[model samples]
Target: MIKEKTFTLKDNYVCTSQHKLYALFSFLSARDAYTFLCNWFEKFPEHKESTFYIAGESYAGKYVPELAEVVYDNNNKKNGSSLHINLKGILLGNPETSDAEDWRGWVDYAWSHAVISDETHRIITRTCNFSSDNTWSNDECNEAVAEVLKQYHEIDIYSIYTSVCIGDSARSSYFDSALFKTNSRISSKRMPPRLMGGYDPCLDDYARVFYNRADVQKSLHASDGVNLKNWSICNMEIFNNWTGSKPSVLPIYEKLIAGGLRIWVYSGDTDGRVPVLATRYSLSALELPIKTAWRPWYHEKQVSGWLQEYEGLTFATFRGAGHAVPCFKPSSSLAFFSAFLSGVPPPPSR
Candidate 1:
């Protein structure tokens, strides 16, 4: 009779932080509220429902994969005696798969999209490798970041051109060179339009990690409870805790594709983070028999993006989008989803 909320995913990621877990629980609780709506339709077995899709951008990209895997795996575990839950498909946006090559790929992408400048990209590129988990000077990093966007006047990581630049210190003491969504325009005022509201959610999200204060400390006290290091210590081990748990999207993609699940992996042409090359490696790793090699697709009746369709996966590029897809190009994005939802995989757009 009714349907789940159109879009309900919140900031749940694949990590193991207690505070983060608490926040994620809140997020899931909200999502469950939405999921429960669909259970109503579970009855009336003959009633056809609209397509159920899992979609999100940026971290959503990373999050949706695990979510879909859970659904698919759960569906498989049903013995002969149980009613199966129907899941339609997934739409992974600018995902941050923590692959070494994938991470480094963002630097080049940010530059190409004019998210950062050539010089700034060069500085950060030469200074630090993307895969390693290390802390460097905020000032220096910001300086290199600034140089990259020297020509753009104001650079925005969210502006479809530089989606891979989502990683950052949410509460930066001083402004850095990398023009984020917040810093696109110069504001002499200490509290700019975006930085208002006394505090920012994104700032607090990172602050809890960097300093360990949760739920907003009314009085910034010296008590051990107020100190943020304890949270940091635990947060430090998050990546280490599940050190080798980077699941390959390729194998999973292959299985689904073989099962006739229409699959597509479209990258932002400018995203060096999770660059086209890494995607190629992953797709080829699926061992799908080659059907069509690389080709191009048209947008606005002009050559737009490169593509490849093999036995299992269909790979394409968003001409100007970064890691995130639909956020950058909504029409093409909508078209992509519409195609997937209809099981109408488009011909290869190389």
Candidate 2:
């Protein structure tokens, strides 16, 4: 029997031209999904007491906190009408919590990892002001960023060191086309290659094949109206419609941490997109007193990651892992999950 339960939400953050006018920051996809979860819990009273923990990675760094705030606010409300969700804690992996810090951190990560030249890094740091939503610090900053980006054109920004799947030679046509489209966003022709270490660069190809299959869709009861053949990893329309992002989640972290909730922010050290450096810089802004000194944590008698406990939040970094920690380091991620849920610290030192 399964001891754990999972509830996944395919939040349609898409807003067409007509629906765009009504779109508000608070009523976006995450909020909508939270409302559904709350209502679901209310309808199914038996599971009301079960410990609920919100978890996500990457962009979810933002989504999880926003949703947690919604849950926390409702739970604390005096009104007896609302159900008190047993929200135990929150878990975030390589989250994009702050725009300014993340961008700033990216330059640092790139430079430190030898992805770009020291001179370029110096120019970027000197000119770029990541504090605002605008892309570049200045004209010079934009040029410096462009110069650095050229170096990463052929590599997977998500996993800087890992190789990505090339065109139809290694994967199917659909996968090749998807990769092409991604590169087209940056106006680059070169594609990424797949590297070793239990990584499957062709997983997107497999997913495209599996989801587009008639029988699989039928079994899952996917809608007939939506064309499976055209399905992509990320819907561009939905991504374009995402208009509610804040500059930083530090304020939200301040509120939630002060309220005494278990918060864990873990990063896969290898991920260049939302690198561990960025997470560190963002968390430093919180200025939470250190509850435990920084140290390495172990799993299966091996060093899994480094973890440090703040007053109410914990920050961790999985060694040699990518943006999606579970995909790259499943065992370590499971260890982290188990510890987060149990309110126990990861084993110190291997």
Q: Model 1 residue 133 lDDT?
A: 38
Q: Candidate 2 has which clashing residue pairs, if any? A: 163-193, 164-192, 164-193, 164-194
Off by over 4 Å in 2: 1-25, 133-137, 168-198, 217-229, 237-241
List, in order, the clash count of every candidate structure: 21, 4
* lDDT by residue for model 2 (1-350), tens: 11101122222222222322121346465567665775576568799889899999888888888778777766775642246778878999999886667777878998999999999999888876665334342567667776665666556667777777666232344234443333233221111122111156656667767777877776777846355555545553445445565556677788788788899999999887788998999899777889999999999899988999999899998998987889888888888899999999899966
Cα lDDT of candidate 1 equals 0.46
Q: How many pairs in model 1 have backbone atoms within 3 A of each other, for residues 3 or more apart or on separate chains, i.e. clashes?
A: 21
Taken over the whole model, the C-alpha lDDT of each candidate is 0.46, 0.70
The prediction achieving the highest lDDT against the true structure is 2
Q: Write the per-residue lDDT of candidate 1 for residues 196-234, one digit (tens) a residue.
A: 001121433454454555333424553445443343212
Question: Which runs in model 1 stand beyond 4 Å of their true positions?
Answer: 1-51, 80-83, 110-154, 160-251, 271-287, 322-324, 347-350
- TM-score of model number 2: 0.80
